[model samples]
Structure formats: C-alpha cells, structure tokens
Target: MSKEVAAQFDELAALYEDMASWPFRHDIETPSVIAALGDLHGLDVLDFGCGSGLYSRLLKRSGARSVVGYDLADGMLGYARRRAEKEGLDIEFVSELQPRFAGRFDVVLSVYVLPYATSVRELGEMCGALAGLLRPGGRLVALPIHPDYQPDPDYYQAYGFRLIPDDDHDRPPRSDGARIRLELCHGRYQASVHAWYWSRATLEAALREAGMTDLVWRDPSTASDPAAAAPLLRAYLDRPHAALILARKA
Candidate 1:
C-alpha cells in the first residue's frame, strides 16, 4: 500500500465516527481482547493504530491509568487529540511510530494494522519495535486482517479508496476452486478491480518469523464460524473479520 492512500484515512478521520454509524464500533472486537489480557485498572496502555480514538475512549471507561494513542495518519491523530481535549480525557497522541516508546505501557493494543504493512520484513520490524518497547511480561495484543480476507476488494478500498491491489508478484497456481473477489466500488455506478487472496500458511509463517510465540488464533464471531465453512475455502474465505492473535514478546 502507498503512503498516499494511508493519508486518505486521516482525511476521513473527522467524520469517521459519524459515517460509521453508532454500531460500527471497533470495540466489537475489543472486549474479548481486554478480557484475555486480564487486569486493566491502573495499568498504562497504548492503543496502537488507534483510529479516531474510539478504542481509547473504551479503554478509559475500562479503568486504564493512562492510555496513549498512536497512528500513522495525522488526520486520525488530529481527531484523537481533539476528542481527548473535548472529553477531558488526557491521551497522548503519537502521530508516527517512533524508534521506541518513552514510557513502558503494561498493555499494547494493535488492532487491524498488520495487513497494511508493505512487506513481511516491515511486519517483522513492527513486531520488533513493539517487543523492544514492552515492559517485561507486558503483553502485545493485536488483531491482524486474516490473510483469508486479503482477496476482498473492499479491504483494499478500506486502506485507500483510490488504490488497487497489486497482483504482479509470482505465486504457484492453485489446484482448487478457491477464489475471492477484489471488487472496487465507487459510489453506485463506478467500480474496478483489485488483487485478491493470501494464504493462511503465509500469515502464520510471518508471525513465526517475527519471533512471536504463545500464539492463539481466534476467528472473530462476526467474521464467520470456522466450522461453518466448506473445506475448500476454509483457509481463505472461511473468515471475513479480524483474527485475534495474542502473542508474547519473547
């Protein structure tokens, strides 16, 4: 993905909450994560890839001592800071990923960030940065766009409304009938194409290469139940939502 498209999200930041409607809450997947993370009271927390600070607000209500919001998009961070100020919630907004976090946070929440990474090396570096910043025993809880959902064109537009998925990379031909659409929709009449499909094994391998362990994968309930899929598409189209990956720094 281009940095240009990443910039688009920031532009949409101000109206994101309203445009999403009330039920489009990112916290739809947050509660289960927090529960698995255990205690939050008085613990310092970081909302990595914090978008519009919705989860940051949720963290405050859950009793975190201090919650800092970080994101790559300035527009999102702008909204976060404004929301913090208006609500009398003190949240430190870091507009870009720094070499290291200045203070130790007990919990780090990285939701829907990995898929946007440009490469496997980039993903590894991100994990390394998080690992280096975490306090010993502090957990790094993240939700990755399941490689399964990579084929959907809507996923590409979500990253940048104008961009299309690149399919020039070489890969082996599939022996099965599995396929995912990369439909690019623009308003009611305009639409185009984008690349679709990433394998589950590749995703797991990336995590392993990043040195992440204690891996536990939970398919989001809203995404679709694992047992509900036919065997052919089970690895890719079986899940449509986020994949909860709880990995330890060590």
Candidate 2:
C-alpha cells in the first residue's frame, strides 16, 4: 500500500468500524464476501489487508480451522488484536505476511484494499503475494471498488455516501493512480478519505500473470441471502459500486 493510503487508514482506525458499519458494508459487502468464500469448515483462512479483523473473527466463527489477519497499519492491527482477545477468539493478527505463511492458507479474503496499488506493477506484486499465500486449489475472494464504478447521484443520496473525484473531469474512466475522495455519512457521523483506483483489465491481467485461474466475477446480489440484498441489488444493477473477484491458485 502507498504511504499516503496507509496513513489515511491509520488516521481512520479509531472510526473505521463505525463508518464501515453502514449497510453497504454490513449488509452488502459482507454477505457478498461470505458468499464468494463458500464453505469455511476446517479451512485455514487469511484475511489480507484486514482492517480491525471484522472478517477475521467472522471466519473463525464460521468454523475456519485457523484464521490469520494481516494489515499494514499498526493502529488497525492493535484494534483487531484487542477485539479478538475480548471476544475470546483465537485469531492471529500480523502486520506482515511472513515467509512461513506462504502456501499455508486455504482461503484468502481481501476487502476494499487492492485499489491502493498505485500502479499495475504494484497490483501484480500483490497478486503474486496472494498466490504465494494460498495452497494449490486454494481460493482468493476480494472485494474492491468496482473499476467501472461511477458515482450515481440517486444512489449516493440514498446510501449516505458522497463520491468526490480528485480529477476535475466530468467522468473519468478507470485509471491507475487515479484518486478519489470517499465521504461517508451515517447517523451523525461523517468521514472522508482518499483512495486510488485500478482498471478491470489491469486487475485481471495481474491475477493471470500471478498464475491464478478460473477467475469469476460475482455480483453483490448473489450474496448468501439474496432477499436481504434485494434493495442494494437494485442500485448495483444500474451501476455496480464494488467488484467481487473469485480466483483460484493453480
């Protein structure tokens, strides 16, 4: 991750959970991630770029044999550790992906983190790291901001989110290093952070170069409970706000 991006997250570590609790995350993204993950029984799961270990704890509760959460920010990892201890959950949270963990996970989950790659090379390096972490036949499920995402006025108004593109262009196509301001408003709280963008082709090529296969794109609507995703689906069908990539290590 870029230092700028890491610093941005570090600053939001205290409020990350509260801002992430918005329906788009709890109701839409979480279910979508879990659905793409399929069964977790007895699997060694790794939550890459795990902020506050939300999905790490969820994986453990879902019967993962072992769960490890990795992040770049110290503050985020601290929060994750505290939450795990308080909940009596046996989760290992690490700041780095040590060599010992290579080829050790059955499933790897990354949520809203990949876009921080400022360049295609950085994205390829990330894919290679993810590939190395997974055992043969292991799966990687990632949720990143949709490369084709466009700010929909109505959707933003209804969902309490404000999209502020860094570029002054009316509507710019997906590009590496493109920055955008993501503003969130839930109840009385409001927060804004900048994020980098990546194009779909760039991501797909990187995954393939990293030796992944059977790539699949899953829509948010196909979450574990379609009924619960119905309302969110309508907005997504018009213009997807996120991308779910399911790939397997060969």
Candidate 3:
C-alpha cells in the first residue's frame, strides 16, 4: 500500500467500525460476501484488509478453524486487536505478512481491498499476494468496486454512500486505474476515501495472471431476513456499488 493510501485508512480508522454497521456494509456487503464464502466450518481463513476485524470476527463465528486479519494501517490493526481481545477471539491481527505464512490458508477473504491498487502492476501484486496465501484449491472471495456500478454519483446515496469520479469527468471511468472518491454518509459519522477503478476484464486478467481461476461475479444482495431497509434496497441491489468475486487458486 502507498503511504498516502495507508494514511487515508489510518485517518478513517476512528470511523471504520461504525461504518461497518451501516446498511451498505451490514445488510448488503456482509451477506453477499458470506454467501460467496459458503460454509466456513473448519476452514483456515485469512481476512486481508480486515479493517477493525469485522469479517475476521464473522469468519470465526461462522466456524472457521482460524482467522488472521491483515491490514496496513496501525490504528485499524489496533482497533481490530482490541475487538478480538475484548471478544476473546483467538484471531491474529497483523500489519504485515511474512514469507513463512505463504500458502497457509484454506480460504482468503478480501473485502473492498482490490480498488486500493492504483496501477495495473499493483493490482497484479495484490491479487498475487492473495493467491499466495491460499492453499492449492483454496477459495479467494473478494469485494471490489463493481465493474458495472451505477454511473450517477448520488445513485446509491439512499444506502449511505456515493462514488464519484475524482475529476468529475467520466461516469463509468473510461479507463482502468481511474481515481474515484467514495463517500460514506451515515448517521454516526461521514467520511470519504480514494479508490481506483478496474473493469471486469482488467480484474480477471490480473487474477488469472496470479494463478487464480474460476471467476464468478455476484451482485450484492439485501439481507434475507427482511431487514428494515429491505424495501428501500431495490435500486441499489439492482445496481450496487460493490460486487462479490469468487475465485480459486489453481
């Protein structure tokens, strides 16, 4: 991660946990990712870019044998460690991945992590790293900014967020690695982060180059148990800002 990107995450650490509970994340993101992950029982999982340990905790709760949460920001790592300690979960939170840990997990889950790669090579490295952590045949489930996300910046505002081109120029981002701004609008707090855009072709090429195969892209689904916002999610679900990607290290 770049110093600037790491700094942005550090700055957002204070609001990260609260942001995790917003409808966009809790009701939409979590469920879709969890579904893509399927049964985690007995799986050794790695939660890459696991800010605040949200998905790490969920992976354990869903019966993963072990979970390791990795992130670049110290503040986020500290918050994640505190949460794990307080919750008495044995998950490990680390700011770096050592060489000794390569190919150690049965499943690798990365939520909203890919967009941080601002260049094609960076994107390849990110995907390569994720692939390296997985045991042969292990699953890699990720959430990247949807390749077909709604163009209008305010289209997803009802779900507490918006994605606008950084330059306010092209709507779908005319090219790969285009910069974009993601705004989080919620009752607890408001925040924004910078991310890059990658089309399905670009993302697939990167993953395939990293020895990953069997790509499946899924749209975010609303909570199945009739969440209060269930009625308000038709549009976003149809044109969600994020997508769940399932693949395997071959």
Error of 3 at 66 (Å): 1.0
Judging by lDDT against the true structure, name the best candidate. 3
Can you write out model 1's per-residue Cα lDDT over 137-192, one digit (the tens) per residue?
A: 67777776454444444444432223234444433322111222233233432333
TM-score of 1: 0.70
Tens-place lDDT digits, model 3, residues 1-250: 5656867777566677777677667777778888889999998999999888888999999999999999998888988998899999999998778696799999999988999998899999999999999999999999898888887888888877788888554544736878888898867668888899999999999999999999998888765643445666766777788888899999
Model 2: which residue pairs collide? Answer: none
- The candidate 3 region of ten consecutive residues with least summed lDDT is 222-231
Q: What number of clashing residue pairs does each candidate have, in the order they appear?
A: 2, 0, 0
Candidate 1 residue 237 C-alpha distance from true site, Å: 12
Of the candidates shown, which would achieve the greatest TM-score relative to the real structure? 3
Instruction: State the lDDT at 240 in candidate 3.
Output: 82
Give the TM-score of each candidate: 0.70, 0.89, 0.93
List the candidate 2 regions with Cα displacement exceeding 4 Å. Answer: 152-154, 168-173, 222-233
Name the lDDT of candidate 3.
0.86
Taking the tens digit of each residue's C-alpha lDDT, what string does model 2 give over 88-183? 999999987869899999999988878777667888898899999999999999877787787543466456676667755544636566777778
lDDT value, candidate 2, whole model: 0.80
The CA lDDT at 84 in model 1 is 84
